[model samples]
Target chain A: MHVKKLRKNTFFSLKGVMLAGIGSLALSAGANAGTVRVTVAEYSAKTGPYFEQVAKDFEAANPGIKIQFEVVPWDNLLQKLTTDISANANADLSIIGTRWLVDFVEQGIAEPLDSYLTPEVKGRFIETFLTPSVMNGKTYGLPIAASARAMYYNKDLFQKAGISEPPKTWAELEANAKKITALGNGVYGFGLQGKEVETDVYFYYGMWSFGGDIVKDGKSGLDSKAAIEAASLYKRLIDEGATQPGVTSYAREDVQNLFKQGKVGMMMTAPFLANQIRDEAPNLKYGVAPIPKGPSGDQGTYGVTDSVIMFQNSKNKAEAFKFLDFLFQPKQRIKFTVNEGFLPVTKAEAEDKYFAENADLKVFTSLLPIARFAPVIAGWEEVADVTTSALQRIYLGNGQIEPTLKDAASKANAILKK
Target chain B: MTAKRVVAPYVLILPSFVLAALIVIWPVNELAQIASHSVNRFGQLRDFVGMANFRALLDDPNFIASLWRTGIWTLGVVGGAIICSVPVALVLNEDFYGRDLARVIVMLPWAVSLTMTAIVWRWALSGESGMLNSALIEFGIIDSNIQWLAEASTAFPMQILIGILVTIPFTVTIILGGLSSIPDDLYEAAALEGAGRWEQFRHITLPLIAPFLNIALVLNTIYVFNSFPIIWAMTQGGPANSTDILVTYLYKVGFRLGKLGEASAVSLVMFGILLIFTLIYVRLTTARGARA
Candidate 1:
C-alpha cells in the first residue's frame, strides 16, 4: 500500500520533468537560427556578458548565425555528453576539455580536423595546443583557450606585511606568507586547493616546478629527489601555518571565494579569475606574477586547454566547420580570449598589441612557449585519478612519496596496458 | 470456438514483455556480457579475458574499501531512519492539532528533488559561508569552520548525516501507513491489562507491524547501498577515495577509465550481494512468523 503512493509520486515527478525539459527544447528549436552550441563550466557567468556581446558581434558580422551556449557544471558533464553522443544527439560544435580528446577519438564521436584546417590556422596556433588532439596521428579539436597557473598576490596585504613585491622564489613566498599570517585576524598568508576534487592540480604544479616528473621510461620516477622535496615542502607549509588551516579541505572555488574576500596573501590561479576579480572585487588590489622559481630556477605550472570539436554525428558539419574556421582567424581568436579572460593559442595573437596592453592577460599567453601538456594517453583520466589520490595520501603524510606514487603508477600502468 | 483464441494472452502480453526486456532485463544481461568481453570505446573488438574482470575486482584493494563504506552507508541510513521515524510516527499518530502540518515538515525532504537536496546540502556544508559552519562558529562552540566534506575520515560520516536527514520523510510515511492499520481495540485491550506502554508495544504493536517493518528496512538498505548523488555532490567520494562505495567505483571503471568489463563485473557482484541479503531477510522474517 505504501509502495503504491511512492509509485504515484515518482511517476508524477518524472512526468513533470519530461514535460518541462522537452517544452524548453521545443521552444528553443522554433526560435533558434542555426545555433552553434558550446559547453563550458557553470561559473562562466563571469564571461557571460562578453559571450552574449560576442554572439551579437558574430551575428552582425556574418549574418544568420545564432549561438546556443550550454554552461555545464564540471560534475556529470562526461555522463551527460556520452549519453547524448551515443544517441547521435550531440551539438554541432562543442567546447571540450583536452582530456576528452582521446576518448572522443576512440569512441569515434568526434571528427578529425586535418581536412578542414586552413594553412593559416595550421601554422598560426602554437603546436602545444594541438598536441592533445594528435593522438595516433589524428586531430580532433581546435584550441579555444590555454591557461597555466600563475601566482597572484594581494598587493596591499604584501605591503602591510612589509613585503615589496610578489615572491620570486619558493623560499621568499614561504617567508612572506609566514609574515602575513603573523598578522592573524582569521587571515592566512597563502591559499591553495587541497581537496580531493583537485588533487592533481595542487600536487602536480608544485612537483613540476621542482623539476619532478611522475613518469619516465614507461615507469614511475616519483622517487626522484625533486618529487620528495616537493612533497616535503607542501607538508612543511601546512605544518608551519604558512597557509590557511582549512587548506586540507579546500577546493578551487573555496580558495577563489576567500581570495575575492581578500583573505589570503598569494594564490596560484588561472586566467578566468581576472574577470571575477574585476567583477566582484575591483577594489581588491592584486598583482599577477609567474609562479615562483624552484632552487634549480625551474618556474612552471599546469596549462589546461579548452577546445571546440565537431561531433561525428553533427548534421551541420559544413556550416559548423566554416564557423570554426572563422574562429581560427587571429582577430576573432583574440576577441574570444579577451572576452573570456583566456589566453589565445595562436602565436600571432600571443604577440598582438592586445596582450601587450593588458599585462595580466599576457602572463598566460607568455607561458605557452614553455608550459607542459598533461599526458594525452587514452586512459589518462584513470591514470590522473590514481596518481592524484596517491599524491593526496602522500601530501597528508599517510605514506612516503615514492612508495605511494609507485603504487599509483602500477595501477595506472595496468589501466594503460591495453 | 475455432477462433484460435489461445494465442491472444501471449499476444496481448507481448508489447509489455518486450518493453520490460528492453528496459530492464536486456541491460542486466548486457552487463553480464560486458563483464566477460573486452571492447574499445566504439564497441570494436579488442580482447576477451573472460573472468579476468572478476579476478581484477577480487584483487582490487579499493574495492574492499568501497564495500566496507557501503556497509556503513547501509547500516547508518537504515538505523537512522528507524530512530527518527518510529518516535515521530507514534506522536503524529496521536490526535494532535496541526498533525498534517507536522507530518509535511517531517516529509519535506522527500518532496524535494534529489538534485536540489544535494545542492542545498553542499552549500550548507561548504567550508566557507556554509550556514551550519557559520552557526556553529557563531555559537563559539567551534573555533573554525568544519570542513565537513573535505577529509576522508570525516566524509563518510558527513554523508551518513545527510542520508539520515533525507531518510526521515520516506520511513515516517511508511510507518504512518503501518500505524493507521492498527485497531484501536488492540491498544484498549492492552490498557485494560496490567501492562505498561513499553511492555504493550513489544508484546502487541511490534509483532503486528514486524512484516511491514521488514519490508521498509530491506528497501531502505538496498536504496541507501546504491545511493550515488549525495556523495557525488558533497565530495565525489573524495578527500582520498575514503567515501567511495561500489556504485562510484563502477562509474569510475565504466565511464572514466573505460574499463567497461571490470565495471560490469563490479555491478554483477553488487547484484549478487543484494540478492543474497534480500533472500536472507525474507527467510528470517518468514521463519520468525512460522515459529510465532
Candidate 2:
C-alpha cells in the first residue's frame, strides 16, 4: 500500500512538470509573434555591430515589431543555413553567396521577391550586380555586397626592382617577377595562391587572359588549348622560383599576408586588400592596377556578389519586406558598403563621395565592363572543388599537366551533367 | 524472482530507455531513411532509390582513398599514444620529486580545446613567418624554412604527431589508474625473490593492467577515429586532398558539396566500420580474459 502511494505521488509530479513546460513554451510563442529574425554573415569584426545598430534603429522607428539578428561567420554560413533549413528552424532572412543562389532557387527554398519589390527599389540596384540573383523571370534575392578583382603591387618593391610601371602583359609580368625575385632576402616575386577557396579562380585570371572560358558550349573548358597554355605558364612560374616556394601551401589570406609584409612584389586580388593594407600596414607603399594581359591581349577580372534572401517558409512576410525596404535605402547602403570596403550595389551609394573620389576603387570600377560573374548553375560548388583539386595537383607537380586537366574536365563535365 | 521485483526494475529504467530512444535510435532511423531515398540538396525526399547512394560512394576514388587514410590515421594516433603514454605513466607512477606538478604538466594539452590547439599548430607550421620555421633557422638546423603543410608527405606525418600529442593525456590518466590499483607489495615481494625491475614490471604489472589497457585501447580507437578538428583545422584535407580522412570527407560531401543523400550513405558506412571494429576488439579481449 505504501509503495502504491509513492508511485501515485511520482506520477502527479511528472504531470505537474509537463504542464509547466507547456506553459513556458506557449508564453515564449506569444512573445515571438512579431519578431523578424535575420541571419547576417560576418564579413569582418565590424559586421556584427553594424547589423546590431541597424536592428536597434529599425525597432525604435517601428514599435510593436521586434528585430532579432543571428550573426554567423562567413566560413560556416552555408553549413549553418543547410542544417537550419533541413531542421525547419531557419531565420526569416539570410545573406548567402550569390553563387549558391542557383541551388537555393531550384530547391524552392528562396521566396521570389517580385511581388514585394517596388519599381523604385528595383531600379536602385546596378544591373550587373543584380542580374545574378534573378531566375526563371523572378528576382529571388537582393545583392547586399559586391566586389571586383584587381592587381595590387608593392610600390617599394617595384622601385627596388627597377621597374617603372606595372606589367601590362603576361611576358612583362614574368620578367618583372624575375627581377623582383633576384632581390631576395626571404622575399618572393609574386604572391601566388594555390591553396584554399578561389585557387581555381586564381588560375582563371590566366585562363581568361588566354581566351579560355570556364564552361563553353555546354561543357567544361578545362582541357582547352587556352587552359593548357595557362597551366603551363603558372607551372613555369613555380618551376623558375618566381613564386613563393611550395605554392600549394599558400591560400588567399596567406598570400595577402606576404603582400602586407612587403615580402611579395605583386598579386591579383579584390579591393578589400586596400582597406586591409591601410589598417594593418600603414607604412607599406602599394598601387592598384589591372590584371596583366595575355599574349593575345585579352584580359578579365572576377566579379562577385553576395545576396540577401528571404525564406519561402517565413510567416512574417509583411514585416520582413518592410525591413528589407529599409535596409536598401541609400543611407543604410552607403554606411554598410563603406564600413566593409565593398563596391556599392545601388546607384545612390555609388555616387557617394567616398566611392567616386577613391582612386583605388576607380581601377576596380573601370574593370567592371570586362568582369565575369560565376556561371549560374546547379552543383557549382562541386564543380569548383573539382577544378581546385586539379589545380592543386598541377601546382604540387603530382600529375602531368595535360592529362590532369583532361581528367578534371571530364569530372567537371559529369557534375555539370547532373 | 517475484513479478513485482522484475516489474519494478523495468519501471525504474523506463525513463532512461525513452531518453535513449529519443536521442540515439531516432537519429539513426532518420539517417537510414534518408540514405535509402533520393534526396534533394536541402534534404527533402524524392523517389525511393535503394542502395544507389552507397553504390555511388563505392565508385568515387576520393572516397576510397579517404577510407584507407582513415585506417592509417586511427592506427597511427591510437598506437602511438598508447606506446608513449605507457612510459610516461610508469615514470609518473614512481614517487619522485614534484610528481603532482609533473602529472599536471602532462595533462595540460587535455585542458585546452582540440580546435584551439590545432589552430595554433597551423600558425606554427606555416611556411613563412611561422614560429617553427624561425626556430629551425635559429638553431642552424637548415639554412631555409620548410613549408610543413605544403604537401601530404610532410603534412600527414605532422598531423599524426599532433593527434598523438593531444591523445596522450587521456591515455596516461587511464594507465596511471591501472598502475595505482596495482599493490605495492607485489613489487616488494618480487624484489625479495631477486627479481629485477624489468621482470617485476613484465610479470606482475603487465598482467594486472592488461584489462585497463584493453579499455584504453577501445575508448581511444573510438575517439581518434571520429576526431575531426585537428585535420580539418590544419589542412582541411587539402593540397589535393592528400590528407583527407573519413570525417573530413563526410563534412565536405554533406556540407560543402551539399549532397545529403551521399553524405548520409558515407556516415552509415563509417558507423558500420566503427561498430564492427569495436565488437571484434571487445570480443577478442574478453575471450582472452576468460582464458586467463
lDDT of each: 0.73, 0.88
What CAPRI-style quality would you assign to candidate 1?
Answer: acceptable
Q: What DockQ does each candidate score versus the true complex, computed on alpha carbons?
A: 0.34, 0.48
Pairs that clash in candidate 1 = none
Instruction: Estimate, for each residue in B1-292, the C-alpha lDDT of model 2 and write its tens digit.
Output: 6999979999999999999999878978899899999988777889899999999999989899999999999999999999999999999999999999999999999998777788788889989888999999999998898999999999999999999999999999999999999999989999999999899989999988888888889999999999888888788899888999999999899888998999999888988998899889978987987997
The Cα error of candidate 2 at residue B210, in Å, is 1.9
How would the docking of model 2 be graded? acceptable
- After superposing candidate 2 on the true structure, give the runs of residues whose Cα lies further than 4 Å from its correct spot: A1-31, B1-19
For candidate 1, the per-residue lDDT at B182 reads 94
> What is candidate 2's lDDT per residue for A1-418, written digit by digit as tens?
0001111222232233234334334433543568988887777767889998899989999897888887666666677788777766777889999999999998889999999999999999999999989998999999999999999999999999999999999898899998999998978888899887788999999999999999998799999999999999999999988898888888788888899999999999888888888899999999999999998989999999999999999888889989999999998999898878889899999899999999999999999999998899788888889999999999899989999999999999998998
The prediction achieving the highest lDDT against the true structure is: 2
| Clashes (candidate 1) | 0
Candidate 1, residues A194-235, lDDT tens digits: the string is: 764445666766777788775665655455667678778877
**Model 2 TM-score on a 0 to 1 scale:** 0.94
